[model samples]
Target: MTDDLLTRVDNGVGIATLNRPKALNSLNQPMVDALGEVLAGWASDDEIRAVVLDGAGERGLCAGGDVVAIRESALRDGVAAAKFWFDEYRLNAAIGGYPKPYVSLMDGIVMGGGVGVGAHGNVRVVTDTTKMAMPEVGIGFIPDVGGTYLLSRAPGGLGLHAGLTGSVFTGADAIALGFADHYVPHQRLTDFTAEIVAADVHTALSRYAVTPPASALAAAREWIDECYAAGSVTEIIAALRGHDAPGAQQAADVIETRSPIALSVTLEAVRRAAGLGSLAEVLVQEYRVSCASLRSHDLVEGIRAQLVDKDRNPKWSPATLAEVTPDAVSAYFAPADPDLTF
Candidate 1:
């Protein structure tokens, strides 16, 4: 009902359009809660045969959570910031586990939270405009919102590479990496929308206006898999640094740019998430880690340096990757005594 999100029914389909175009549809608490409510309602509505999720503008589907809000929350009440992430993660799980046929019009910038919404769908439509990434490490957070599950399902060490490096993938690369199901021309969105409204999705999707060739991400598969398999983020960084390949060095740059603590915790979460039984299980485990992350050394510092001050010079605790301790890392997985139920 809020302008942040709009919902309506046309024929047998329920449509949810993200309306915050200026922020590239970045999710705030209101948007997250609203989306969760609408999705939950549609899940039980027998008249709603399917759902179409899209953003209002041409820029992208969604960027991710509003980190500026997170930064402000961190500045005000530290524990409340943790609660925000917890609630958002639960909403992500609800969308992923929704029983209805959720179709995502994954155009524009589909990263982090965007992927959480689109990737879980029964049908995911990707366009040339779609630029997909986890990129959570770049912002000093782990890729939550079922991202750990998608990363786990990625080919070989690609999950680790993409998760750690926060690299962007083109539509073709997205499909090859199993992040997207179909690709279509960016200009044909109107036709695509029309088909979904007509409730003849299968037939409408069969025709494509344009298709691009494979992307560079696919070509670097062997190197990504071999290099990313190292024991730790530091080890992975060393491995990439040691390689003579230019691509390895480039990958190393990304790893080096990220918050050492965020990278460390994210790798651990992804590894742990890979071992879980289902999407819900992965999210629950991630919730435990994230709750603890609020009190961890790097999160607030990371947010301060990146979003609040806009300096990008985060004074990460432990200072260097080598100084990160196992016990410190273990704290991220420990249950918060009050325990977050989601």
Candidate 2:
């Protein structure tokens, strides 16, 4: 509680450590506010030429948002919960568009909110321990925090598959999908950090980037693209079910367990984000989609099933992909007078 985000400077590099190791550095309202403040301060500071974000624990960089707090806040005062999400989204947008050389040493599990912060950085470093994903569908929430934008740009149908299935990927998949810029062994991070700390502010650090020896995921792109190219959630499910690979079955099981409504919305969100004009534009659209998600979707029930009750069977609103009406899905994209202007 005392230490959420720890800030320090080493040879002009401003390093922000997400310090809630017990929670895998999950983002809470206070942590989001703290990040916004720190980012705002660093935006104009010339001395802090680079920024490095890392997590404190062995398990990962950051896991996801603090769902317990979100649920509690919603139960207490719905307006407060809305405000918190709005502020958190703003912080995510700011980081996505931040001008400085922002780097993330994504050493372990990076998912949900973590991907928005780490993978969106200018220099995203993945390690052998890194396992990346945008798994909002698993918890009955559509991916937010500008994830729709990033997922939209991923090669082939990878975005659609990932958004709908809540599939976890290794550091290798991250690099193949363009989510991460470089891959290095976790063991080399300390030496790499020292090199970064020692370098002059004006010097470009691209030379120090370490890409791992070619990974097998790149070779499996054909299968990934072909199997995931289906436009609808049901089609993708059918395709996955037909595949004999262990990876395909694992992904299918995950899809089977998630909220139907959340998965549909996530697929739609990524597709919509892909057509947007800019990252900021996509983020604003995501904000609209997210605000609508709280009231119109099965997020509450999803959380209840998976977290509150510990019952994995979530009674999704629509129950199946076909039951989700086009009008109901379109409502999430409807414009507001005081629209989400990220």
Candidate 3:
């Protein structure tokens, strides 16, 4: 009954609207707990044939988890952070394995935690305005919520390009990258929403779905695959910097802005996740990385510069990519105390 999430049922379709438009529908702890409980209940409710997830306002579906709160918790070693991640990751696993048809209307800005709630659904709809990314490294955080899992499976080294650079991609890129199933223009959104509410998803999609516009991400795979498949982030950056392709140098610039520690850990995590057998396995890995990040110096500094101070400049320890040792990276993979059991 909290105001953050609005839920109702119509035509046997359970609908959940992320209600914090002012904050771009960023998820808070209560929102996470409530969403999990609601989804769990809907799983057993025979009257509910499907579920629909969307956000309010024209700005975006969601910005992400409440990072301002996360930053504060990190300042104190964040016992609260561990629990928040525990519940959030569990919700991610549930959504990935959700029994009923789960749909996410992924229009407008979707990033970080936004990708978690929107991308894992069975049916995801993107609009022309859709701008999606998993830009966790920029803030000294690894992509959690099975983000490494999703990015790991993207075609060629596109996932690596995305994870390393934290770049934004369009709806066409979303469809091409397997993060979404359909493209419905933004203008048709109201009609599409109405259709799904009145009838079933299939009927609504059949009429509304259309071919996506071109994907620059897909088109640039030739260079992206070659540059990002290098042995290390340093090597990849070198490759991008040397390559003569259109966006290669720009990609290198973006990667350099991220925390060296976060970048190293994230690169390894995505590679490991690619070999992982399931989303749950990847989530388990993400949990370990996230818990480790909760205690890291860069996580606090990154948030301070990026969010608190608005400085847009973080003085990272082990600032240079060369200073990041395997030991520093390995700590992220060590067994987190009290492992998260599926």
> All models: lDDT?
0.82, 0.78, 0.91
lDDT of 3 by residue, 158-242 (tens): 8888888988999999888888989999999888878888888899899999999899999999999999989999999999989
- Top-scoring candidate (lDDT): 3
Q: Considering lDDT, where higher is better, how would the candidates rank from best to worst?
A: 3, 1, 2
- Segments of candidate 3 deviating more than 4 angstroms: none
- Model 3 whole-model lDDT (C-alpha atoms): 0.91
Residues 299-329 of candidate 2 have per-residue lDDT tens digits of 7777777778987777887887788887787
Stretches of model 1 off by over 4 angstroms after superposition: 209-212, 337-342
What candidate 2 gets wrong by more than 4 Å, as runs, is: 200-208, 213-217, 243-246
lDDT of 1 by residue, 1-342 (tens): 578999999998899999999999998878888888999888998888888999988799999878777766766665666766667777777777779778898898998888888888878888888899998787677888789888888888888888999888888888878888888788987888788778567756776534656867778887788888999998898889888889999999988988787888889888888888888888777777766666655667776777678898877777778887888778788875555555
- Could you give me the TM-score of model 3 versus the true structure? 0.98
For model 2 the TM-score comes to 0.91
RMSD of each predicted structure: 1.8, 2.4, 0.9
lDDT of 2 at 275: 89
What residue pairs are clashing in model 1? Answer: 60-109
Judge candidate 1 at residue 296 and give its lDDT.
59
lDDT of 3 at 85: 86
How does candidate 2 score on lDDT? 0.78
